[model samples]
Every structure is written in structure tokens, then in C-alpha cells.
Target: MKACLILLLLAAVLPVSAQQLPVDAVKGDYIVGALQLPEAGVLELQSPDGQLLRRQAAPAGESEFRFVALQSGRYRAGLASPQSQGRVWLTEQRPLEAQLPEVAAPEAPLASPKLRALANELGAGTPAFWAAVQASGAPWIEPIPDHPQSWQVSFLWRGDASTRSVRLFWPVRQGDQERFARLPGTDVWHYSVRLPSGTRLAYQLAPDVPQLKGAGRQAQRRAILARVQADPLNLRRWAAGTPALGGFDNIQAEHSLLELPGAPPEPWLEPRAEVPRGRVEHLRFQSQQLGNERRLTVYLPAQKSAEALPLLLLFDEDAYVTRVPTTTILDNLIASGRIPPLMAVLVGNPTRESRSEELPCNPRFADMMAGELLPWLAARYPVTREAGRTVVAGSSYGGLASAWLALRHPERFGRVLSLSGSFWWAPARPPGFVAGGLDDAAEGEWLTRQYVAAPRSDVVFYLSPGLLERSAPSDGPGILETNRHLRDVLMARGQRVIYREFAGGHDYVNWRSELAEGLIALLGAP
Candidate 1:
């Protein structure tokens, strides 16, 4: 009774955190959900600007997750898991740029006048789309609802000054957007479009621009058109924009035209050999440093590469290699031209035998990649030698490892892909919550101190979490707290972070879906 009273008195005497509203302003639609982790540990979340929001804890026993409910914005997340040994920076959850899906509809029109206006503007008959695209500087999209069997098209053009016969693209519905058609023999060039019926496609209108300042090619086009093509079950054999014997390929409508110069920060994937092979190379290697070297496998592509290729190294080797088999996804994406061709190195975590040590912030284990493994493979294949060419990736603890590589050895890794980063700062609080009277103000301060000193970098962060978690009912800073805490830290450091949360529990399905888009956002698209 005396001890209880003394504790109560201590709590009463401590300073109170300024009262803020609960995460009440947040709606599920606004939340970026689906935070799953490997080891259940405590985490603290923050805003992009470092404001303490909500808090949650993920213990070590189960793979529970904690997500943050933040205002819609670009934010980064970090994870520092707790251990009897010490608190180590594990993974910094990638940031969440949670764009609501409804926003996509408004963005879909190409611009505003309305759907009909958008359609008309691109010959799909929409002026709103034209106006919006023109005003926003977004790409032109052709809305093609009527021509189910016909290809969609949006033609934003730059006319040739010399009025020479300039080769042009053949626009079509559901055609690729990543390719360009060069004019044949300087004659009047006409791009063709072919597609099957009942197929829906979104299209972009682009001008044939100069190649390496070449003077021979002249052009004509303006306010490039955004076109769409759809047909009523026409079932065409091929949607070939490129004519036979031509050097170019179809620029599918879904593909983006421009790719950034440098590799994406993290959580973004560039290209991978998307076609999974019939026989998986179920290989395993033991890391002397990592202890039980779990199943570290590789998926070799059947399609040959002229030169050695870049690699997609996935953390969380178990689930990602098994259930999702990111390698398989890469193979398919590469074959479809949705993404580029690259190899996959699915690195599993250390066994429960040594997981606690290997996944944490240990520079020794990091050496394995930089010193021995990465270079050994590079010697054999034609892989990118630049740091930017390499993508250090994983989820949960794997997420921590990816981000850590960038910070610990920037010379070695260009980007990191962390999902549901386990920033395990203890914000022992309750659900649907914010930092409570904390039981004490000093507790929050201590957490701030712990986070302020961790290693970090300009690596891109892809983070997502479940909106809730399984922790003591009285614990503060559940999901919201952890997300907010890290979001603030990365943003303050001026790191490129994409923080998001989903309304789901900690599981593989959520991670699989989140990480799938993560590849595109990190490498596939960016």
C-alpha cells in the first residue's frame, strides 16, 4: 500500500503533457493501414514535423503492429526495437503518402470540366480533363469509354518547325506508355493502335521529343492529348503501336513516360525479372555473424540478360519469398513490361536462434553485405556498381536493416525499403489513443532523447502500419504514437519519407499488398 501510494504521488507530481484532442479528427479513409511486423516490440510514432501524436507497442512474442493516425501528408517513419541487450535502430518504416482512392477518380478525369468534358477534350469528349491537365501540369489522359474495341488516345503536341515528315506514335487503348515510335525513312509517320474488345485502358498524350539533341527530327503537336481506348469484347490479337521491323515497342498506357534521374530513395522499385521460373532455387547459406542463416533463396529468370542486371534484395525472406515470392512478381512484371528486368535476392532473417541479434542495429552483420556478399555477386554478374543501383530492402526488422544500411554505410546502399518499420520506442499507452498524462511527462521526454540520437540518412522510407495493436489497455502512444514519432524524426532530418497506415491487423496479406505497391513506388514506378 505504501509503494502504491508513493507511485501515485510520483505520477501526481510529474508534469502533464499539454492536452490535445484524441485522434478523433481522423477517419478510416484517411488512415494508411496494414502495419505488420516480424517481432512484436514497442514503437513510437511522430508527425513529419516531429509532433507527438499517438503511441503503441509491439511486444517480442507476436508479430503485432502499431500504426499512426496522422493528418494527410508526406511523412517518414523509423523503428528502434527494444532488447534486453540494448535499444537498436532496426528499420525506419517507409513514409506514407496515403492518397485516398477517391482522389484518384478526380485525378482520373485528366482535369475537371467533368467526365464528359474529359472524354471530349481527348476526343473522349471531355473539356474538363483538358483544362485540368493544362492547368495542373499533370500528363494528358484520354478518356475512352465509348470505343471499347478502339484504342484510347490523348494527343498533346509539339509541331515540327520545318514541317518535315516526322515519325509519330500510334495511339491505342490499353497500349503501353513507356515506349516511343520513331518515324520511318523521314516520310509522313503514322503511329498505329491495335487492341481487343472489352478491354479498358487509360492513355496519355505525349509529343515526340528530341533524342540527344539530334537535328534531323522535326515535330508538331501541342497541349498533348490524353486518350483512352475501350472496346466491347472485340478481342484483338495484339495492341501493337510499333509497326513490324520497327525499332520501338508499344508505350503501354499504364506506364509512366518520364523516369527520375537518380534511383528512388527507398520503398520504390525500378525493374525486376517478373517471370517466376518453374523450379525455385531453394538455397540456404549460414551467416557466421547472423547465426542460423535462414533460407536465403534466389529466383533466376529464364529470359536472358545481355549484361548482368541490377538486383532486388528483399528482407523478410520467409514470407516474401514463400507466400508473395517477390521474385515471382518481378518475373511477371518484367515480362509484361510493367517493370524492368532485374534479379532477386530474398534474404531471410536469422533464425529465432539469433534473430534478436542479427536484425537489430549491429554494424558487424551489416559488414556481411558490404564486405563479402554484395561484391562477390557483382564480380560474377553485370550488376550496378554504384550505390544508387543497389536497393537494400525488407519489411519489419528487415525494414530496419534496409534503412540502417543507408545510414551506417551510405557508400554501399543507395536506397532502403522498409515496411511497418519497428521503431520500438516505448509509448506504453492505450488504443484509439494519444500520449496520455503518460502516467508522466518525463517519459515522453526520455523517448524524445532516445530517438534524437539514432543514425539516419536521406534514404527513401516506405512505411505502413495497422491502425491498432495488442498492448496493455493503459499504454499510451499505440500505433499513432510510433508512427508520429518516427515521421517527425525523418522529416526533421530532411529525409525523403513516405508514411502510411491501413485499417488491418499485422499479417502477411497486408504486407504483401503494401510491399507490392512499395516496389513500384520505390523501384517499379519511381
Candidate 2:
């Protein structure tokens, strides 16, 4: 009788402070929270991984919750009796500027006592429960904070038979291994990992059994087909589906795109009604060197064509046109006279394997661009043949190819815009394979030594590195390190090198800005 009276007294007094707390919080900041409850109850705090960290009793009123986060990540705080919860981010310490709200109660259950009871079991404030709900009956990835420089991406999958493990096709993971955690008492799987800011990554999730490792390509692909899925929770997707490659069929294989915070703004990516737009011509022709037909996207500036207009050959043509907003950028740059009126030919790769095969320091690819593609473009368009007026540009592997083209055929492509170039490539070592391991001097130092051994002139190079590009598998030395090494080598060889670094990852999101900067620096009118 005394306990029931106390509970009634507490419930009446707890509902008075019905204010919502500030959602944003940093590590080590004290949070003064409020919970209107029928009685005093225990509040539980959980880590990002769902590990119970602390539990303490709170009175039915405004209460002080002190926190000191040792690391930067996401955390969950909730109370038991009324069952209310909230999310907190522990980054750099900052003052709380918002008011706390009354603790919320669990939703009244309708049917499915099992699910309802489970929902009550896992606090509504818990990331685990929220992740499962957002997945909408499919695998999901929910980033803790919408805009985070370093993100803790939570992966969720509901349990089912025939699946042993879920694997991620991400580069930074250790040994491309599968790591998943199952939720207690629920048919749900989860895993979380931290990634740097502005990382534009395309990845797929696959359910695999150990037996599939030794299976044939067709068999493995069949198994993969049953399991591989784009993150259901992540709304952003890669612009296009990656075509088939290396006999493994996934004709419509689409990967999910995760764009971390701090991507450099490419103002030209959006079409501005005020800015004059350029013309895009889609052209296709047979390539004698590659033994296949290829597609081209040519951007013609708004300015009237000249008898000898400078030309820029951009690899990964489709991506630049659709993803980078190339035409819009050209229109703006040409209108403002930041760069001279020039023609740009975007060359598309037929397949992922073909792109990888051709874009890396390949002599045949260089020959194809200089001997076949250039002449074909010049025949139809009034473009300059002078090397000084010609530019070869690309990002990542294409960046490596751009530098290789200028070095091999300076008479054709005299200017190179290499954004996050794979300078770690070498004649002896295949990309990403550590033959004898990291001790091999040829890792990222390959291309830099080539320039040291046989220096070339008449080529003006624009080298840009993303600050967040710390490592890549095939390149050995990673993205940023390789670009820096190449820059140092170019400077030492007395080459005219324009080197710059931007705040981003080794992604197109970062390269878009570098592309604009490089063009203006190399082709800008005085």
C-alpha cells in the first residue's frame, strides 16, 4: 500500500518539465536530463556496440547525468520504468545549450506479444532497435550522426537460415574478413566501424559460408547473387550500375554509396540558371588499339569554336559527365573567363576489369590515346595538335595514366592533371598485392623512381592530394603518400609541377574541386 502511494506521488510530479533536450552533444560534457516517471527507476547507458556501460537510479524529476567520454563515438542513454531513450555523440567536449524533455513511455502494444515484448526489451532509444526498424526487412547501414567527419556506421541484418556470415567489400578492413555481431535474443546481426570524413565509398554486403571460398567463379557468383545486397537503410546509391567483369556475372551489380561529412563543395555540380551552359555530344567509334568499340562524351564550350582550340582528354568520361557535372563546370569557368574556351573529350571504360587493366601506367593505353583517340577527335573537331595546348586528366588510376601519357608522348599531351594518382604502380608488381610485404621498396616508390631515372620535360603537371587519403591496398603507399612522392620527384627533376592538397578523401567528391583548381591553374587566361 505504501509503495503504490509513493509511485502515484512520483508520477504526478515528474510530468511538469515537458521540454525536449538538445540533440547535439560532445564528449565529456555534463547533460542535465529530466524523466517524468511514476517512481524512481534505473537509467542505463550503452556504448555504440550495445555493451552495457553503466546503470544508476534516478529520481522522478530533473536529474543531472555527468559524462566523460574517453573517445569520440556514439552512445545511448535510457531509463527502465517508463522506457525513454536518447542518442548522444561523444566528440570534442562542448557545452549543452538545449533543455531536457519529459521521459517518454513505450508505445502501447497491439498484437505480436513476442515482438512487442522484444521492443520493450531493447530500449526504443537503443541504436540496435532503431537500426532493425529502419532496415524495413532488409540489410541496413545507419550512420550515427548524419554529418560526421569520422563516422561509426552501424550495419544491421535480420537473422535467417542458410547464412553463416556477412562480409563487407570495404578496403580499410583487415584482410577483407567477415565480422558480425548478433543481437542478444533477437534474430538480428550487427557490426560497426569508423571511417574518415568525405569518404565516397561504394560497397556491397554478401552472405557467405566458408565452403564458398574454394568454389568456382560461376558457383561463387551464384552464391553471391543470393546474398549480395545494397545497404537498404542507406538511401544514397552509386549513380550507375557497374558492368560485369572477370567472368563473375553481376550485370546489374549496384553498390551503396556512403558520403562522409566534409566533402568539398563543387559549386558547378548544380546547374545554375544564370550561368551559360555548354553542349555535350555523345559519340562512339571502334578503337583499333583496344580491339573494341568505345563511347565518348565531348563537352563543347558555349564560346564559338576556333580553328585550333585547346583540348583536354578526360578518362572515366561517363562519371565526369553525370557525376562531376562537367558541362556545368565548363560553362561557369568559360563564362567567368577563369579558363580558356576549350573542348573536353570524356572517354568511358567498357568494364571495371578493362578500366583497371588500361588505366595503370599501361604503355598500350598511352599509345591508344596518343595514336588513335587524338587523331579521331582532331579529324571531327577543330582542336589544337600542339602538346602545350593539350591536357590529359584523370583521378586515381586514371590520374596515373594521365601522367604516363604526358611522360611517354609529350608531343601529344603536354599538360597532366593527376588527382590522387596511383604512383605506387610498378612494372614488376601488380596493384594492391604485397609480394614480399611492406618492406619492398617498389611499393609506392615505383613511379617516383621512374621519373628520377628518366626525367621528361615540356609537360606541366598538376598534382592534387586529398588529406584524408591515408592508404589503399594495391598501391602499397596509399593515395596521399604516393602523390606526395611523385610531387617531390617532379620538383627535383625541374618539372613544372603545380602541387596542392585539399581537405577530403581519395574520392570524386574531393577530386571535383581539384579538377576545377587544376584546370584554372593550367589553362586559365592571364
Q: Cα lDDT of all candidates, in order? A: 0.43, 0.61
Candidate 1 regions with alpha-carbon error over 4 angstroms: 1-279, 286-294, 425-458, 469-472
RMSD of each: 22.8, 22.1
Give lDDT tens digits, candidate 2, residues 297-321. 8988878864688998988764576
The candidate that achieves the highest lDDT relative to the unseen native structure? 2
**1-526 in candidate 1: lDDT tens per residue?**
4534533454453322111211222321121122233443333445546674333333222221223233554333333344322122211121222221211101122222342454455544235433454564422223336754333332232224332212223222122232333222221112233223222222233332222111121111110111212211122222222111101211112222311122122231233444344234756655664344455666656567786665667765555644454655665556665555666777755433244455544566677777766876677556766675567776555665676666667777876666655444323443222222223432443333443676555466666665432223454544445655767877887777777764333334345556666556666655
113 in model 2: Cα distance from truth in Å? 29
Task: Give the deviation of candidate 1 from the true structure as CA RMSD.
Answer: 22.8
Candidate 2 local Cα displacement, residue 213, angstroms: 4.4
Q: Estimate each model's TM-score.
A: 0.42, 0.61
